[model samples]
Target: MMSYQQLLDQRAQLEADIAAARAAERRAAIAQIRRLMSEHHIASHEILPRRAARRARLLEGEVLYQDPVSGATWAGRGRPPRWLAGRERELYRVNLESQDSREGR
Candidate 1:
């Protein structure tokens, strides 16, 4: 039988392994999707919302779909709006720092 400490250690190891596997899966999925897009000539940016991220850090953040062939980010101008990239995170910080809204953006 495993001791309590040993069991805890095993649990931690399993959790870590699971997390690593999930990251690998995400990377693989990204690659496969890119290949499919290329094969099909799909043109569009991926607008992913940071749902799992901290509400403060998520400020309107989105992963602009990048061109797989050219390695340039989407949004036609060689990338999405710079400020829009992490607007959500900024908003979260502002909301945290400003107790009362006296200043307006």
Candidate 2:
């Protein structure tokens, strides 16, 4: 029995209510986490594992080799891609100009 405009307004109001509820829930969850951290005297750094720190450092640097056919690139740091097996890495070496161009030089 509601008019079209009334139904639209109701929908908008419901959306706003849902957003407010979600924000309140997030704030409550964050407060609970803070309380738990304080109770255990846990530092923020202690909450983060050491593997993440290592990964953050390792992700830097540039691609050293590439597969010309598949366009797959490797930074030449960790294990070489299987496609590179039995092939000369020098043949797949990426030039500085190509690397710079790809990075929006």
Candidate 3:
């Protein structure tokens, strides 16, 4: 038998608690990430592959590419036009040796 004002206040308090909990969780995660980086001898600002921004993303049959500056995920569905530059070919081969070794051909 809560009044309307009491219900609104309860909702507001719950929302604030959720936000505080989220912030605390974020801090904990970042601390763990920092500890792992130190243990692995990785730089603090090391960049990893970006994640997709869509609601339900999958990589099984999707093409992989990154926007160097903004790290936006994009597909490579269509054939490249003749005007595409040749130098871009080398940009996609950053970890060439790992890829070749994986095939073990």
lDDT of each: 0.56, 0.87, 0.59
Tell me the tens digit of each residue's lDDT in model 3 across 1-105: 999999999999999999999999999999998898889999733544334322123333232454455554334446643333354844532343563466562
Pairing residues by index, what is the TM-score of model 3? Answer: 0.44
Q: Please identify model 3 stretches exceeding 4 Å from their true place.
A: 44-46, 49-105
* Global Cα lDDT for candidate 2: 0.87
TM-score of 1: 0.44
Model 3 steric clash pairs:
none
- In candidate 2, stretches whose alpha carbon ends up further than 4 angstroms from where it belongs are 53-105
Q: State, as a TM-score between 0 and 1, how close model 2 is to the true structure.
A: 0.49
TM-score of each: 0.44, 0.49, 0.44
- Candidate 3 residue-wise lDDT at 72: 47
- Give the clashing residue pairs of candidate 1, or none: 59-88, 59-89, 60-88
* Per-residue accuracy of model 1 over 21-104 as CA lDDT, tens digit each: 999999999999889888888754433335534343334342234443444433223444454465443332333234233333
